[model samples]
Target: IDVGLQTKSNIGKQEAADRAVVNLETRYQIMNMVKDFVRNPANKNQMIPFDADSTSASASIKAYNELVAERIKLGSSAKDNNQALQALDTQIAAMHNNVVSGVENAMRAMRIQINQVNQMSANAGSAMSAIPTEEREARALYRQQGIQNTLYTFLLQKREENALVLAATTPKGKIVDHAYAQSHPIKPKPMMVLFLALVMGLLLPLLLLSVKKLLTTKFSTQDELAEIIQAPVIGEICHNRHKSQLVVKPGKTSSIVELFRLVRNNLQFLLTNDGDKVLLVTSSVSGEGKSFVSANLAASFALLDKKVALVGMDIRSPRLAEMLELQSLPGVTAYLAKPGMNLSDIVQSSAEVSGLDVFVAGAVPPNPSELLLSSRVNDFIDQLRAHYDMIVIDSAPIAMVSDTFSLAKFSDAVLFVTRANYTKRNLMNYLNTVMSRGQLKNVSVVVNDTNPNVSTGYGYGYGEE
Candidate 1:
């Protein structure tokens, strides 16, 4: 009964809303017709009359048309300044206002009816929805109660069956076989424990070594560096226990000095041509013994009485002067900044190496990269070529700065130095990238600071002091 009443109310309200919409459209059309006749009543169409409709707006238009016709007739008989004509104008304006007001009132009434119908329809819909909602909730509650009762009955049946089984009992029997100890014990097998311990003891160091090798990211041995770089390792200089910069002195016969001698001989084979004199020494980063290599390599050449000039081109970080215990000023920076300055004024002869000359980095410059790009650098290399048999430039690190690339064009060969266990594997990959890109030419690697014990194992102990 409740649902039926709500449905009837919804249907009635919906029909009312439809009627209100139709009335609104009719009123809107009538209002337009009245407004047109009032605005220009003289041009009224005879075929489609505004007064044909039964709406109040249609009656208003008919009255307005009569007033217009009356005004036209009175104007033909009266003067322009007559009082009757003025009164007629006033009447026409009042009637025009009345027609507009009637239209607004009709539209406003239609809108109110529409709003009321919509409210009633919404209320009826809500009422219609509640009946079904309550019925569904009641049905759901009944279904849930049935499910609970069924579940309880099933649980009680299972419990009763279990109780009956527990109350009843079967006949007891004696043990057919008894537990006994076996001849061989299951635990504490001395042979197996000892075997396992022996196996672990044998494999532990190997496992640890394998793990250490896998975790190590830097080059620790000569074979490791060579296998990864795939480049010629021209020399492997041993770790200098004395920590001297000039390990290749004329009279020194230690392992470090002999290694430098080997490097000097290898370079001789690599740079066979006389013009292969400009050797640029650099590394992936700083502290890889590049300065040490550069200074010592030049000194080794000097021992052969070859005129050698070791130039410090790492102007950003001048280490040659400090390593060689020479003054930093009036060297490369001074020579390049002042074109008129003589090369002799900046070049200083090493006291230790009689035939070798040292061109210090002078001072740290604000624009070292730009300075290396100058044409004077090439000219400096050319001048050194004319005077010396060998020119070794200790330039900036290739990875850390672009200054080395700028100076690389002036080199005949590049000696890349990487310290043992100090240079990362990724940097070696970067070197490969550099080589693959052909950014450098005639490149060779020199592994510095290798363990002396490891070197002796490589059969290079013949010259050890």
Candidate 2:
């Protein structure tokens, strides 16, 4: 509605400008015509001497009257005598006729000249007379134009004033009073929004928790582990903030260390003969604490006075050497690449745990799968088995690489590590596949990085006893 009003105002102003332009043009034309008429040479003939012509004719008639009076006196004086009087009368008559003829001729010429002058005066007067009518018409037109200009100017001014008023004020609208909260908010209801957010903050976690419990198949507790896999969970390692891979120490009494002790003790039940058990530790994916569990489990076994060898079989990306702070060179890749390389030359002792030994992945090779499949690797494992009581091999993620499958063949058992809330449930399909194919033997899951909130259901706690 305001737009329509503004449009109308603008149109009116445009029409005003157009009318002003036309009025100015007409005024210019009228002024030009008046100026041309005033400057015209023919109109100057209105000053013609018609009165002077009449005065000249009157002077000639007076002179003729004086001559006639003179002739009449001569005739009157000679009329008493006989022949002389008659002759004098004839002479006077002749003179009188001559004077009369000259006068008449002069008067005729004056009349002709006066008539011509009068006609010229009349023509000039007629032209001049038309001027007043033209002037009146021009004035009337000018007055009309002025009036129109004034009207248009007034209209334009009013429009401008209206526009300014519209620009300065808000539009009128129907008003009604309604109930509102006291103390109108300046920036919005920040406190109210915060309270609502706090409520959602309290409820959102419970909602997500319920959804996770209903929709997910991933195990979060020991009961879930026992129910799904139908196997004993050797250990449940809590989440650790340690930067190193080997979390277990000989004298450390941390919950993680105690958990590893429990796992080492429970691992004995899974062994049939316990003659140098070769355990392969791997996960379906990386970052599930597979390497952490392998190194710590070895450290735990070493604390048990059993000679333990922790081998980094994941040549693709080795972290055990760096995690244990040992030299990565002269290890598995080098031992396997060189013909007749002794296992003792590659094996390095761990300084943290007295009985723990570590073999790094050594230099990265292009084909880790092929290297692990080589006959030399089997011989290397066998030699390590003869030397160490427990050979815990930290292999590559089974889901990502085939290195673990090759290394798993000579192992006595495989401990699959899965992190709670980290490892996906679909990995179970891959584990079941490997088990069904006979590629894995005596496979057990070690649920690593379990949340304490979830472990509470299984009565697991890390508090000091």
Candidate 3:
């Protein structure tokens, strides 16, 4: 309502200012005509070109026309030195000066009126700014009154209902049996209690296990995950028995390393492009060891003497540098944000693995998705492709944020990571939906942290032992 009132008021003010401007323009036209008459009296028309629409200038134009007509008649009938003609010339000069003064006065008045209207508009705007707070208070009061009214109505109805029930109710008493006292106590039979206890002990374990199985929402095995997702389970990584997150180090032959090697092989087969391959490694959610998988997988590829560039694309929560124990230097974000930054300026060599360069996620940015959405990100990937053979991008979880989806377009293939017994089973259903909709390109799954016993059947220790 306040806004409507302000708008209506401003419209009125604008119309008033427009009228003043029109009146001012009419005065200017009158002044110009009088000046032209003074310059060329003979050619000046006896009937002035009067504007019927200009009410403010009508009287002045009439007087000027009369002066021009008297001068024209006297100049035609009498000598140039005649007194009447001279008198007419003096009157016409006075009228011309008057018109000039009127035009200047009209201009000044119009300026004053416009400034007044602008001041009023400023006042109205100030009032409008204060309306929101007043409106909020009014609405709050209205809501409180409505709540009270509803509560009072409900209580009144409930009171009337109770009164009606009381008026129609009847008192009746009946006894099913009389209270009695027993001579012996019941509930303390020793042999019965012992037998029940033994029965409960026998059934408790089975009941607990059944409930656990029924409540299992996460996949506990690789096959359980593989059965749900439409994509192939490229390979599975066993649970790392060691404390260090990096397992595929130099001169290491652990089962985890061997499994990563297998995963690496499967990824190589999936990306069949002749030149550089861009692989996006992400998970349904965090804490699924995607960073660990990314670091180790890159190491595994580096072990094959392939030039691998591991980029930490997860600018939201960058853990790749910390996990690799590398100094947190400027990385992909710098390359995307700064035009002068080169790949060598941000790329740091991995001390733990040779032939592998780590691109830290750089400083955590506030707008990670927008940064990745930049066209420079594609150029950054192309730069990596030109330099390295394999570009492994460890991105954010697909289910949690949109940063990965923006990076997905630049990848040749996707390596979706899921941890066994840690990742929810429903995530595979979501992944299947993503694959069906073609949101990701050439998608594959890599199950991380599976039970060592379940994964050892593939003979990870074929010749090491």
Best by TM-score: 1
True-structure lDDT of candidate 3: 0.76
lDDT (Cα atoms) of all candidates against the true structure: 0.77, 0.69, 0.76
Write candidate 3's Cα lDDT for 1-465 as tens digits.
676877567555544544444444444444455446445657443444432223444466567756766676556567878888888878877876665455445546656765675566456445445446776467447544654555456446646753544333322434689999788767688889999999999999899988986798898677877778899888888777787787888788877778888888888888886863899999999999999999999999999888999999999899988888887868788888888888989989988889999999988877777888888887898889999988899999999998888988899999999998899988888888888888997888988888876664244454221
Cα RMSDs, all models: 32.1, 34.0, 40.9
TM match of model 3 to true structure:
0.54
Question: Residue 413 error for model 3, in Å?
Answer: 0.9
Pairs clashing within candidate 1: none
Arranged by TM-score, best first:
1, 3, 2
Q: Candidate 2, which ten residues in sequence have the lowest lDDT sum? A: 44-53
| Global local distance difference test of model 2 | 0.69
Better of 1 and 3 by lDDT: 1
TM-score of each: 0.57, 0.53, 0.54
Global lDDT for candidate 1? Answer: 0.77
